[model samples]
Target: MAAVDTTLRRTLIEYGQTTLAVVVLLVGWEVLCNVLSVPKWLLPAPSQIAADTWEIRAVLPMHFGATLAAVVGGFVLAIVTGIPIAVLVVYSPFLRRVIFPFLLTLQSVPKVALAPLLLLWIGYGLHSNMIVAATVAFFPIVINTATGLESVDKELLELTRSLDASTARVFWCVRLPWALPYIFSSLKVAITLAVIGAVVAEFVGSDKGLGYLILTSSGAMKTSVMFGVLLLLSLLGIASFYAVAWAERRLCPWYLPTNTDPPAI
Candidate 1:
């Protein structure tokens, strides 16, 4: 109970600090824009963006839903494929040699450059955007999971072997638990990347989503609405990141890093 209380209190403090910082920044921005009399098209004040966001609320649901769907779909696909690839890479030297180089090369290619190819191959739409997101989000998960699986202390592995534990038992009881933290860490990163990937795909080829809205609004010189779309995209990314973090905490409560743990009282 005491530990739980400490953790909860620490979390509250961190959230409060973040909220205060954001409020201060927004207030400063609003004041600067008002004092300078900046035009809305050049740099929309937060107030103008907020007002425009409200006015566009009617159309927000559809565009937001499209982007959300693409993001989620792509993230899920990355997880589904990435973990298995990591496991294979960890357990099989031949597979690792064959696959890891390919993955590294693929990761180096800019997603924007590949987006057009994906559109051509997959056809433009939700599926293509989801594939783009998956491509962007895949590498971190694979690397992290593989690293975690390989990170078990050598002595611990020897001890497990001496105890005559089956491979499955060693993996289930030792390797998987150790990997959870790394996996979840990658998941948070991948989720944010997924959002960027989806937006990139939309930018390249799609007629829908917040990215499309931003593009169209910019072309129309509706900078306030473009800012509003950007704000919405940021919120979506933040919410997705926290959702992954919440899952991480729930699944691996014992894995807190030293830096993040609350100070001793």
Candidate 2:
């Protein structure tokens, strides 16, 4: 009962803080717009954005689906490919020494600048978008997985060795479990990056997706619609983040419990 009460209290406090911050932001935005006489075209009020959301409800879902597909597809690809590569790198010191520098260089390259080239090569649409998204997210997963695998305590390794554990057994029983947290942390970061990548690809070349809507709306000075699309993008990011968080909670229940308290009324 005490633990439950404490958890509830913490959740309520967090909810109140979030609500306060949002209220403050909206109030400031409303005041600033009125005082500065900001043109609707330049900066539509929050209400206008809300109205625009309803106005575009019909088409918004289609665009959202397009972007979501790219993000999820690419993220899955990154995880599948990156994990194996990370395992290889971690298991082989020679491979790690030889490839780590190249991996760093590849990661440092500006993916946005390469978007056009990707479009040119893949010839637009979902393939190009997925490629870009996967590229953007791949490095983090690789780095995280490698870090997790390598992070196995030396003492743990020695103990396993003393027990005459095989390399595969050590990895499955000791290293992989130890690395799960780090892998999930990287995944959270990668998911957001995947969304950004999909949006960038849409901006560069695509008839569909939120990024394309943003481009079209901005060009036509449909500020309200632009705001709507931006809102959708923000929601997408939040949804992806929370999805990962939920998965972490389920898969790693030993790590932490979900805070379930409601805000004080």
State the lDDT of candidate 1 residue by residue for 35-152, as single tens digits: 9999889998998998988998999999999999999999999999999999999999999999989999999999999999999999999999999999999999999999999999
User: Model 1, poorest ten-residue lDDT window?
Assistant: 256-265
RMSD in Å for candidate 1, one decimal? 3.3
Candidate 2 segments exceeding 4 Å error: 1-17, 257-265
| lDDT (C-alpha, whole model) for all candidates | 0.94, 0.90
- lDDT score, candidate 1, position 67: 99
Clashes of 2: 0
TM-score each candidate.
Answer: 0.88, 0.88
Per-residue lDDT, model 2, residue 45, is 87
